[model samples]
Target: MSAPFRDEEFESAWRELDEPQLEGGWQLFTEAMGVTIYRRYDEETGLYEYKVLGVLTSCAPARCADVYMDLEYRKGWDKYAKELYEKDFSGRSAIYWEVKYPFPLSNRDYVYVRERRDLEVDGRKIWVILARSSPETPWDEKKGVVRVTDYRQSVAMESNGACGTKVSMNYFDNPGGLIPSWLVNWAAQTGVPAFLTDMQKACDAYGDYQLRK
Candidate 1:
């Protein structure tokens, strides 16, 4: 019924990343391809929350944000996206996404609400997109699919003058099933960068995709 996440939560996240520090239990995980990632462990859930900062030198901030929010375009580029669509719950809109998993593992799915904001602070333009899981949804769970109950993702973008867009992302999710610790660690260390690389390529191609449409 109400907003999935509070306005203060988004503001706090953006403010913490404004200067970008490694305090508050966040440890540096890896740095590659101009992206720096940090992870924090959740004691109760035994999951990790990741924070990443990078620069996408291929496009402007607004363009990057547009590509990130475009669900139709995502189906073409996102290899893991098996099924994706949007639905309206009462008056609020939510997204349904099913992600592919390796053989012998069930697919993971998510139902969440997302919001995008274009803001100006101190004469600098900023774009932010926030998403979090919604427990109440109209869609019934599909057999053989593991619905992720705990998921949150946020992105903050700003212009980099002549370079491109400076981006920061925070992510966490719990795939409900028996997953090995090694596999989770591997995904965190390797998967984040791989996704970012794919996103950059998608941004570069977005202009042509729009022209065709």
Candidate 2:
């Protein structure tokens, strides 16, 4: 059985991911693809987590939301996706993602459950999409691949005046083993921009791709 969704626990995540405070230790990391990125060090995990916010220019919220829901298209823009398939009812899924590492660094793989829900935030509607690795799925020992165990991620997007969408997310995955903190930091530093860039591209191409179908 899936873990019960505790109201308070989710509420906490909602606040952190949706109503972020860009104050204090949250430092600006990068800005690109119309996205602004921020990060803060977490002493508990010894990892720097990321907070990203952006608006996809001229893109509707439904389009942004649907692009995320449509898994196949994800394979095209997401360079890391190896396979994406549903494992159960609802939006629960298993995504096999391959992380591209520089020469001599072992690539990584993550098998996680990505779930989504539409809910109200501050009287406005938004989509709360969450993902994390499931313990039920045992780690496959693949050659030259490191398994990511500690992972938690969420994307929260709300419509902007019916014309565009405001997107925000928090992503962190602890790739177990001897991976250096600097490398992890570098990934977080660069990954956010690429993700938002592709998302915007996907939003732009989605319409044309459908018209031809």
Candidate 3:
């Protein structure tokens, strides 16, 4: 049988996070139950990207954000973005927060980065695609899990400057497991929003702060 999971190790990762990341900008840390995404954004992309560093716990319950930028400032997101909201968002639990915003992307600029996907609860699938003017690397290319699931979907978005924003959407559902069905179901439905909202606030604050100064 598998050994019981421990949270102590995960907690240590947060403590080890560099405090220098929080200088000059704002830092917000919120928790639901089992997940916590630390974020930092500053005047420099290096520091803004570095602030929200690493995936602490790699499981179905994790998500992270990096940086990327839009190349054309004049080009709007009207074509790329259709609608932004959460379908399965749970209002009763308050675990999921829906974030909707139309952020303009600067013309010919790559000022933001994206995070690697980490988490696999069941046959769930994780994916990341960067909207760049030029071809680079696929953001979702990582280890752990593959094969996108049938009944799963979630999208996350953020803008860090005048142009360019990154949106990451993942869909998955963990069914038929040893763990309590309710617990698994709850997390499967709620994890995406909880993680995405934290990222939104961090990026928004950091972006605005950087622009002001």
**Which residue window of length 10 is worst by lDDT in model 2?**
1-10
In order of lDDT, best first, we have 1, 2, 3
Best by lDDT: 1
- Off by more than 4 A, model 2: 1-4, 8-18, 22-25, 88-93, 121-123, 180-182, 211-213
- For 7-90, candidate 1 gives per-residue lDDT tens digits of 776675566447775788999998887888899999989888999988888788888989999999999999999999998878
lDDT value for candidate 3? 0.28
The sequence of per-residue lDDT tens digits that candidate 2 reaches over residues 123-199 is 87777777787656644658878877778887777776657888888778777677776766666666667777778
Q: Which of candidates 1 and 3 reaches a greater TM-score?
A: 1
- What is the TM-score ranking, best to worst? 1, 2, 3
Candidate 3 Cα misplacement greater than 4 A, ranges: 1-168, 173-177, 207-213
> Model 3, range 1-213, lDDT digits (tens) per residue?
112223432222223322322444535433333333333443432222212222323212222233212212102222322222111212211011111222331111111122223323253332332211111212221232221111222333333222333333322222211334454334433443454444444444444444764
Evaluate all candidate structures by whole-model CA lDDT and list the values in order: 0.86, 0.73, 0.28
Residue 120 alpha-carbon offset, candidate 1, angstroms: 0.5
Candidate 3 at residue 13, lDDT? 26
TM-score of 2: 0.81
